[model samples]
Target: MKKIAFATCVHLGLSCIEEIYRIGGSLDLLITLKDEKAKDKSGRIYLDEIANEHDIPLLKIDNINDQEVLSSLKEYQIDWLFIIGWSQIAKKDVLEAPTLGCIGMHPTLLPIGRGRAAIPWAIIKGLKETGVTMFKLDEGVDTGDIIGQGVIKLDQNTTATELYKKVDDMHIALIAKYWHDIVSNNVILTKQSSADATEWPGRKPEDGEILSSMTMDETDKLVRAVTHPYPGAYYKEKERTIRIWSAKTDENDGEIKLSDGYLIPIDYEIEGNYGR
Candidate 1:
């Protein structure tokens, strides 16, 4: 049986673990980092339960760069290292520790939409298509040779939460289908074209703030992109922060004399904080 080391710190990582076990893949070691107890868009408790269920060797490391973690991984003789949703940029030594090298599962199509929150960013930008990429990890952030990629079309009404589910489904299927080839080092990797790729800086909580000058369409996109599983969008109203759960865009190009910074709340829920 092929031995694989799985490392991650989010719901996606947990899902990957469940999928791997369901497919009868060997999980020789599991590494996870401490994360906030906040629920994801799916309202699922992260990877904690899966780790306990599988009884996979777990490493609760504060940082991936820790020498103790590195030494433990070496002792396990990990054949393949699979990473998903790990926040820290891994060091070269840890990445190359596995005999087959490390593979990272990214939420966006390679060379484009690189960096954090790729799924939400793609939807907010009104992208027609986005997908997942499992690539060889390098020194750079998500800049690696692609081992496999799967694309999916985006619908006009697709919210970030919805798009995430589609990507998650694609990830599970791809990993099961390709794990053998990846572990054997027989997989064909395509080079990412730098010219065709574009990068987004990632969204900050402040980015979710609804600007008074923003158009209805822009506000709608913001609300949809961060609703539910995300913390939702926010705007200041009467010295209190208001959270927007849902919104609809009105394409009225005609002049309506509405005061600037005056917003019509279609649907909302108030939160104590201005931004998450």
Candidate 2:
């Protein structure tokens, strides 16, 4: 098996590594974000448990492209590096450190949606179908050649949390199915077509703010797009901000009114106090 170094800082990354370990695959090193660096990033989790359990050398880094990280990768003599659930893009030096090209996992199908905040963007854009793509890392954002991909169907009611879990499962499944082929140099990569490519811009917490002018369906999509693990969609009420974690449009008796109708909030929070 090839020497593998994994870099990740979220649940998806953890799931992939765990799946690889479960299949008795070898991991040479584990790299993750430093504690202080993960404060604002949603879904960030400590991967220490997996590293400790497998006795893999764990390196916490603020930047994946730093010289220290490059040095470490060189020291380990890594053959392949899998970077999942990490926000930063690896520079050329770091990407080249591994004997084989670095690999990245994106939530949406490449050559379609190829940038940040893929989950929220998918919902906000009213995409009925999105998929996960495992591709080789190149200079451009998510422009690498595809190694594998799996389709995921989306409904009007698919919340960010639900789609998140599906994407996570797909990440693990991809690693489980392809690790052997990757290590053995038997995997084929298909180049992404530029003519069909589209990009999603990174979303901010303030993007979750709900406007009174928005219709019920728009409000519902925003609520579902940023709920739970991501920031909750909110509306400012006088001196307090009401965060809507979940909502349904079937009821018209709800307190918050939209342009078209009202949404019955399934879950909400006001100044840290959770409510229904």
Candidate 3:
């Protein structure tokens, strides 16, 4: 069996992890991080679960490039490394450690959205369609040779929560569909064009603030882009900060506008967990 290594976070990493196990390769090593905020009854990330069930070696780290991490990874003798939901950019030294180098599964089509919060950024920019890509990792942020890609359509109403799931499904599908072709060296690696490469920084909690001058359509997209699983877009009102879980651009929609401007939010009430 060809030995392989996996790197990713637990909660969001399942889309790739479960399938990797199911595909039946020599997943002898798994590297992950501890998420303090995301919890479950089992108190284990999927990485821990997979390691326990399959007897795979597991490494949890704060820095993927730390000397200590490098030391431990060397023991795996891995032929390939697949990084799914890892948040940091892999350093060149580490990226070169794997015999075949590392593969990063980006949620957006590369040479376009190549940074943190690809889903939200695409939606906020009013993109009609955005997709996923499997690429070979390089020193630069997401500037990798493309292995395969698939598209997902979006509209004015696409929310971060919904897109998150769709991206997860695509991750699973891409791996299933292309694992053989990728591993056997039967695939083509398309070089990314420097002229088309785009990179943006990750989003923070404060970055979701909506501006008062945006058009109704723009504000609506921003709200949906950051709703639910993500921190909702909001603006300060008097002494309180109000978070917008959902909004609409259509004039005929049931949302009653209390005020009007280029784009301004109105008051409304919501019920239930509302997709918490």
Candidate 4:
């Protein structure tokens, strides 16, 4: 039986871990972080159940690259390390420790949307199609050889959260469909071309702020890109911080001049002084 190691930080990681267990493989180790503000209860309990079901030794590492983490991974004699949604960067040692090396799963297709918030960035930029990729980890951020990829269509009205679910589904399918091929080394790996790849800088909370002077379509995309599950786009209105949760852009029939970063509260709620 192939011995595999699983590392993750959020719900995405939890799903992968479960899939690994379902495949009847041996989990040498399971590494995860504690989420302080989990909205879903099943996420916490699900991880616990999987750990118990597989009888896999579990490690709660505060930092991904901590010395203890490296020591624990080495102790397990991990053959493959599957990483999902891990925030911390994997050091050279941990990546190299696994016999078949580590695989990093990204929500966006390689050589295109490479960054932390791929889904949101893609939607905000009005991308018509996006997908997920599972690749071999390398020294650079998301600059890895592609093992497998799955694509999804993006509609004009698609919200970030909506697009996120499509990517998540694609991710789950890819894992289940190709886990065997990956372990047996039957999978085809392709090198990501540097020329066609575009790097997207991850978004900050402030980046979501819509400029008043921006066109209706641009503002609409921004609004949807940061809607529920994500921090909604916001702007200052007098002394209050208003967060726009839902909006619909309409064509301006008459002359209505507005400045950049204008707070047009079509539909919003006050997020307290700190902006939630």
Q: Model 4, 151-173: lDDT tens per residue?
A: 88988889887887887788788
The candidate that wins on TM-score is 2
| Preferred candidate (TM-score higher): 1 or 3 | 1
Give lDDT tens digits, candidate 3, residues 1-276. Answer: 456788877555665777866886447788877555334523235567678888888887777787756676678777678877665778877888877788888888888888788988989888899999989999877788999998999986788989988987888888888777766757688999989878867899788776656656767887888887787887665455667787655443433332343333443333234333
The stretch of ten residues in a row with the least summed lDDT in candidate 3 is 267-276
- lDDT for each residue of candidate 2 in 1-276, tens digit (9 for 90 to 100): 778899998877887888887997879999998888877777789978888888999999989998878888889989889988787879999889998979998899988988789999899888999989999998888899999998999999899999988988888888988989998988899988899999889899999998878888899899999997898999887767888899887535677877877777779988643343
Residue 87 error, candidate 2, Å: 2.7
Q: Which stretches of candidate 4 lie over 4 Å from their true place?
A: 23-26, 34-46, 253-267, 271-276
Alpha carbon lDDT at 198, candidate 1: 76
lDDT of 1 by residue, 1-276 (tens): 456888877667777778877887768888876554323534333455666787777877778878866787789988778877676778988887877678888878889887778877887888889899989888887788898889989866888778878988988878988877865667787888888777878677788888767776667677888886777888775557777777655453322112232345566877664434
> Clashing residue pairs, candidate 2?
none
Which ranges in model 1 have alpha carbons more than 4 Å from their true place?
Answer: 34-55, 251-264, 271-276
Candidate 3 displacement at residue 163 in angstroms = 0.7
RMSD of 4: 4.0
In terms of lDDT, which candidate is strongest?
2
Residue 13 local lDDT, model 1: 75
Per-residue error (Å), model 4, residue 51: 0.9
lDDT of 2: 0.87
Per-candidate TM vs. native? 0.83, 0.88, 0.83, 0.86
